[model samples]
Target: MAKVFFTSDHHFGHKLIIDFESRPFADVAQMNESMIASWNTVVAPEDKVFHLGDFSFLNKEDTSSIVARLNGYKTLILGNHDRGRSRNWWLETGFHEVSEYPIIYKDFFFLSHEPMYMNKHMPYVNVHGHIHGQKYEGKNHFNICVEHWDYRPLSFEQIRDSVVVSEEG
Candidate 1:
């Protein structure tokens, strides 16, 4: 059976991200290669992957090439940086689906490119990216940024298990 996965903020083909995010990769090529390998290592072609955002910073040609090499049926939730292209343009670039705003998943998880304002009083758990290594203080928020997950997409089970919801605020 196909499994579901979530990830964000690859910033592929963006050289300056290494310096800005203090990524260990020596260059953009290395970063891209490493991330692609990591992604394929765990995800099968039949698996479903929701990419929260910042999938790539390359031109359509280059982005399409990279996306073609990746495993899984990929969905993208647009990030602030991803606004450079239209939703249809992203579809043409290889994402199976694209969304300009956050969406609810499993009646509980809120998926988005950037962290949403979630609280203990709310019934939702926000699974998001964009803040990179930083994470919110409560179980109501989950950060799936590549920077926080060893450069690979995490499975939904992984996120669910790690996020221990408490009964009390």
Candidate 2:
């Protein structure tokens, strides 16, 4: 069966990201290469990946190249930085699909580019990015930022089995 994975905030070609987020990489090139390798390591060409957004800061041609090199059938949920570009632009860049709002997956997880303020008491969980390396204090809210996930995409089971969720708020 094809697995579903989640990830966000790639910011490819954004050199300042390394210093801004204090990323372990020495430079942008290293960060990009490592992220690509990490992504391909777990995701097969046949799997599905939900890239929650802020895909890249590179030009269209460059962005397209990066997308082509990665594995999985990608679906994009647009982020703040992803705005202003037409929906067609994202599809043309290689995403199998694009979304402007949060999408509910498997009737449980709320997938969004930005973290939604969900309570632990709620039945649904919010899996999001945008807050790189930041952890919120509850089970219902999860952050899948590249900086937080070891620069790799996370499988659904990996998330579902994670201890990120707490038994109490």
Candidate 3:
């Protein structure tokens, strides 16, 4: 079986993304290229990757090109920024599926953006991205943004090791 990977909020080609958050790249193009490079390095052609949201900063044309350069079979969960683009734009880019809600896979639940209401009701692990990973520490939630770019799909085991379950129970 192929390995699975999850990541989100690349915001490729968006220069201001770095301004709002401290990231390693100085510009959007560089950020975009680096993410593509990193993804190719970690993900193989047979691997499945889940890109939660905000895949690109450019128009659909540019986004499609970048998607072609990356590795793996991609599934998208639409984010707030993805609304302006047409569904056809995403469909043609090699994405297997696209939606604004959650998807269940094995022992985990995937959301493109975070869901504020699913906390207590979810039985499996919840994997999501919108907030950079570094922003929260020791919490059950995992953020993919570490050292600047989002880390590609990690299993529930990988995430659980870094997360601390709440003591309220």
Candidate 4:
């Protein structure tokens, strides 16, 4: 059976992301290779991955190659930087689907490129990225940013358990 995973803010090919986000890697190539290796370790060819946003800062050639190297069927939740790029551009980069706004999954989890408000009354759990290393305040909100998850994609079970733990604590 295929599994579901979530991750974001890879910022591939962006050297500045290392300094801007305090990423441990020494350079962009290291960061890009590391993330790809880490992602493949957990994600299988049959699995599906939801990449929240900021997928890469690569040029068309780099973007195409990078996406092809990754494991799983990938879906992109368009980030701010993802704007100005055409739908075909994203599709050509190997995204199985590209969404323009937050989407409700299983009618329970809300997926977005940016952090969103979520509470018991809101009706859906918010799973998002784009805040990098910053913490969020909402109860049902979970950040799947690469900065938060050791640069690897998180399984659905991992995300759900996090929320359960947060609620209990």
TM-score of 4: 0.96
Q: Write the per-residue lDDT of candidate 3 for residues 1-169, one digit (tens) a residue.
A: 6777777888777787777777778777777777788888878899888887777768767878998888888888876777677666787776777876677767555444663344545565456667763454333345654333453456444555544344233
lDDT of predicted model 3: 0.68
In model 2, how large is the Cα lDDT of residue 129? 91
> Residues 28-147, candidate 1, lDDT per residue (tens digit)?
999999999999998999999999999899999999999999999999999999988899989999999999999898987899998888866888889999999786777788999999
TM-score of 3: 0.81
Candidate lDDT values, in order: 0.91, 0.89, 0.68, 0.89
TM-score of each: 0.95, 0.94, 0.81, 0.96
- Sorting all predicted structures by TM-score, with the top scorer first, yields 4, 1, 2, 3
Question: What does candidate 2's lDDT look like per residue over 114-135, in tens digits?
Answer: 8887865777778999988878
Which is the leading candidate under TM-score?
Answer: 4
> In model 2, which range of ten residues has the least summed lDDT?
160-169
- Which pairs of residues clash in candidate 3, taking residues 3 or more apart in a chain or in different chains? 5-153, 6-153, 133-143
Residue 166, candidate 4: Cα error in Å is 1.8
Off by over 4 Å in 4: none
Q: Which ten residues in a row have the lowest lDDT in candidate 1?
A: 160-169
